[model samples]
Target: MRAELPLAAVLLTVVACQSPTAEATAGPSGVVTWAASADRMGDGIAGRSYRLVVHTSVGGTDLRIRLSNAFGDRPITFDSVYAGIQQEGAELRPGSNRRLAFGGERTVTVPAGSTVWSDPLPGRLPAATDLVVSLHSPDAGGPASGHWMALQQSYATQGDHTAEESGAAWTVPTGSWFYLDAVSVHVPAGTGAVAALGDSITDGWQSTTDLNRRWPDYLARRLQRADTAVKGVANEGIAGNKVLADNPAQSALNRLERDVLSQPGVGTVFLFQGVNDIKAHTGVTAEDLIDGYREIVERVHTAGKCVVGATVGPFKGWHEWDPAAEAVRQEVNAFIRTSGAFDAVTDFDRILRSPYDPARMLPALDGGDHIHPNDKGMQAMADAVDLTALDCDTIG
Candidate 1:
């Protein structure tokens, strides 16, 4: 935690920082190589410098990052920013650290409820690499925006140490990714990307931290090795997020444009949400969830993209599991499989469920929570995705 500073001290006005007029200037042509769904993080800290570590999917030249202040009530200025390759812990690979500028300036202020992308850095980033982004906010507070459950350890410190490649200055370890939301690279002209819009399962819950074992991570590795044009995978998943309602994390439907459609080179959207809404018992029936899926598919198609719907994985052993919810899940899964509303379908329930007990997760795949999957289960889910189905040719 940051030193306890008065709210007034951190809430410096935009004029005080001498920030430029904030706008989301369009970035260079590229594909999103990595992404994490953003939500309302706790209040920002004054003089907090964050060294956020993000894993790359499909790497290419001219790397860029998107910083978000989507939930802030006032403008926030990022005075200094740097990108580098992680060598160990908080240390960067020497000579790989490079300064990043926003619209040709070393600093950029992002207004409330907006996101800004930095100009592309000249370099070729390989696949499955750990890319590090270090930044400092001189004066920041109010509602901060970030990805909540990173499942990857990051570093932080006070003051502007954005240019440091040594881990000596960064002594604090944190799990959440602050400000940075997405990373992109210019790939082959025809190459495209896919966004996995899901909940905790897709958010990598129960998987080992710092080791990218999330299902989407596995899928990314597969895309790199296989002969698929859709090589980029963006995990736009938030824990406890739902398809119908918003709370701590915005609902999938509400955040669709920002998290998925708006991302660069997105050709496919994999929908894997609904367990939260179904188990919460918020008077949401199979029909209600089905309607939500229809809307997502329709909207994605309207954006000239393809949509892949996954059946809700079985969770009979979870604390919230009940016969009523199971019935709704079954009905929803049935619709997802046979209705043909989606551009394609992945039967996650069929893949993760125990053969002996239709409604229970396989013991080997269970992450102890019954709802989330272990590392092996995450691999299984990724293996079940047909790489060919991600092609955007299916789009109407």
Candidate 2:
């Protein structure tokens, strides 16, 4: 006795029933828990598999990975990718390995100067866990994209062995992280992250290898246990990087968008750079460096994020130090301390400088070269950060 519905009405009803939720259609709402700024590798390797081990800062479900081809002059094809918990050297925890796909496909071709994020793997990734990502590239050539100074030991193999859980095939030990750049996890809706944009000190140059002793790493550990909503951290530092010019790596100003602003769920850009610019003797004045910093702060503010400035640490014992450079360093630190240009400031110079001689670094913290901080110094820098300042929602 019921009347028949029109075909159009029936089709519309079916479509509505099959539609995904608003959140699902919008993509995974995840925050980056770990990231390593990418740099150009000396030479690219083809037909190789990489077992990259990275530490997570926050715990959450729905894990995702980011692969970068930023410096590649040609397209790179990744045939297979997997993620798992590390049991030991090149070995994965049993029953924890899961395959990752891009757009529902196992293989994805990333165009030159582009990046791709994988579909989320459903599972809870604990904070501070060693997450191992295995990826195989069928053809990876041209300028290789990776973090050259990982300060961690990752493994590699010659063929398509990404799904293997054992270490038998992964014979080559690599200090650099290849292709992979960022890792994300779905945390509570309000959780955010901070990106440390800096140089060798921030990049863990003198920090012990495979120990996660970098200042940023220590900061991440603190964030994990704290009650603050800012629970994620990304280390965007590059060894020998400068604020105004490119030395061995891209300048902080030039790579700001690619390394800091582009990261997911980042709420603050922690600027801890400029030592190289002052010591390089490149005729870069405090005005020039300040202009560069202002530009970065403006750009990040435009993107709706806060900026936390860190004073440049003292480096009087390095071979490049001179009176002119020391004068410039002092002038720049003065501005960083009183500029009101940043939302917050951390006086790393005060933290690492010797009380006896303000121009020199504390002997206990100096990592032999007097330029980079030792592991204890790294921890001190992290401890100096006010966690509440990182949770600011207003841009400055």
Candidate 3:
């Protein structure tokens, strides 16, 4: 079960698991949305482009791409769009590029507040490589969404909101690139999947925009190195998601089955939530947080799945971090390290916290928000994982 670390003024580190295996598998088919920005509150202007580059292993036979404007109120317009293989550090020019068609036409109008999957294209993918996709926008402001990875490096066209005359090219420096939506890679059968279920910390917020340095990415890299039978980690961390009923965006208890259990062939879960409830102003105490975690663990076990609990890290400087909340944080951390409700415990708090400053975060890991970790901080969190819990050969 799950356990927690003791309340002591000491630093602790543990080498719990080995490198994981990584192998590319067939991705889903039939209109998978590339990416969607549900909230369009941010700025969409010139020089602010959203790019996605997907890392895929060779051997896929068919591929396709799409664009999303799920949060936009009006139809999104694009001047140009292009897709091509990633070469060296950028997308290869038209000789290796393909034009995506919308309704048998090069340009298409995506209805407001919805997603449109791409029409399939005939293409052969190599094993273990990156696909760089890029997009551009002529108009200064438009609602947008972006996928974490794309195969094409540039998309350019005649004017804003116009895709009909767009052409696939080596490079277009004028228009603003929007975002890469999604891609479909054909894979052989019998491929397993990994899903990292957590909060915004796992959403790759502060990490370099497209470096693919998130912990789940790191875990995928590890698995690739080990030749594990698993495919890749589909990240399921919503920025504001939580463990209890406090978060309105669907709590962990409410979405567990859908986000974690309902996923296809999931072998492991890395639980990295609950700090929200502990630091929330609702007065939820430490014991209450533990009970909430316990309930989640019980449900995961009932599903015949292995669960790993990551101790809630400190948030002393957070807006809600008060003495009362700090006390609860300590209590919850202790329970996570010692309770044994989970099959294994990951000491994320210990690894990310400052040994010199017990009350605050380590300066290096702090994203300046004190509540979340930066790129280096995220790397540290990924480095803290103990992969042995997923070892069916050794796990009890």
Candidate 4:
């Protein structure tokens, strides 16, 4: 038996005990290969199981998972969780499923506005593989936390079915991923990662589901084949999200720490937001938007990471289009193209804009919405990213 200490002393002791091990495991070699931004869930369900299928960007050993309750008003308890390779619809490959522990315990209770990482599972995870995370919450309710739009098909069911490897128990299909937000692995010493911080375009909206056609997904493929050391990719985009304000999701600035910087081995932040802020007719000026971008760049730089800024794409035909908003867009794009504040810049407006109109998306690449990009446009955006820009080693 041990004697109890004051709460503050106890907290300090816990931190002291955890820091050394964290520093060791994160030693210059580990990287987060995949991530999904956690947003406030619309509704909460009790006693349910979820098997989320996510595509990996880089292969490595000692795979780990991060569970978030960032928006919950109460603590959430996860009794069981498993990680494995996806064989087919909700089915895991034979002998691939493995149980995960939290702080040496099988169960973990995440407090509101907090996250917890599972102890690393020893094994090899291949790049581009469909990795599935199965989780069961004994009591999950009140402002649930998750990504609202996954752009992929994941399965859910009632009760404690997380330990099952077959698809039979997971009968309900879900478009959103619950609780689990990130997966990481131990890569070669020189490997690193990039976090794409943007809106629906970066979120793969309108792209084919279950195909891994997001621009970040394409970028991952490019990194794998290129001669660069930046091999990990984390897509942190939300549909209808804004850079300066919160609505569909928290503002990019507000969530940057949790969504971008906190991931292991992140070397750069890819900023590709602002269209929503300009089009909302919220009286946001070009200067206001530029200031937001500058803040993001400064904050990222302070964290020892590089910033890659992309010019806002044209949206002349969208419902909210107007001359005033178009003027703001042009001004913002000019700054993004000419401003040396960003460590690197990608001219997405130049790559996706129609040559004939110069103010609209190319017809062939438009996803019919004129605002979001089709698969071709998504691929084109990824292609335009200079693989070298993502491999900056001098920054954090």
- The model with the greatest lDDT is 1
lDDT of model 3 at position 186 = 48
Q: Which stretches of candidate 1 lie above 4 Å from their native place?
A: 1-25, 394-396
Which candidate would rank higher by lDDT, 2 or 3? Answer: 2
Query: After superposing candidate 2, which stretches have Cα over 4 Å from the reference?
Result: 1-28, 394-396
Write down the TM-score for model 3: 0.63
Please provide TM-scores, in order, for all candidate models, with all chains considered together: 0.94, 0.93, 0.63, 0.93
Residues 322-342, candidate 1: write the lDDT tens digits. 999999999999999999898
For candidate 1, the 10 contiguous residues with the lowest summed lDDT are 6-15
Candidate 3 per-residue lDDT, tens place, 214-245, comes to 66666666655665555445566666667787
lDDT of each: 0.89, 0.87, 0.56, 0.87
> How do the residues 1-396 of candidate 2 rate in per-residue lDDT, one tens digit apiece?
454331112211111122122222343468989999999996677898999999889888778788898999998989999888889989988766778877666777888887887776766788888999999998888999999899999999899888888888999999999999999888888999999999889999999999999999999999988988999999999999999897777888889988898888999999999999999898999999999999999998999899999999999999999999999999999999998999999999999999999999999999999899999999999999988889766433
Please provide, for model 4 over 1-396, each residue's C-alpha lDDT reduced to its tens digit, 9 standing for 90 to 100: 464321112111111123323532353247998899999986567898999999999988777788888999998889999888888999988777778877666777888888888776766777888999999998899998899799999999999888888999999999999998998988878889999999999999988998999999999999999889899999999999999999879999999999998899999999999999999998999999999999999999999889999999988899999889989999999999887888888999999999999889999999998899999999999999988888777532
Each prediction's RMSD over C-alphas, in Å, is 7.6, 7.7, 12.8, 7.2
lDDT of 2 at 228: 89
Cα lDDT over the full model 1: 0.89
**Which run of 10 residues does model 3 get worst, by summed lDDT?**
18-27
Of 1 and 4, the candidate ranking higher by lDDT: 1
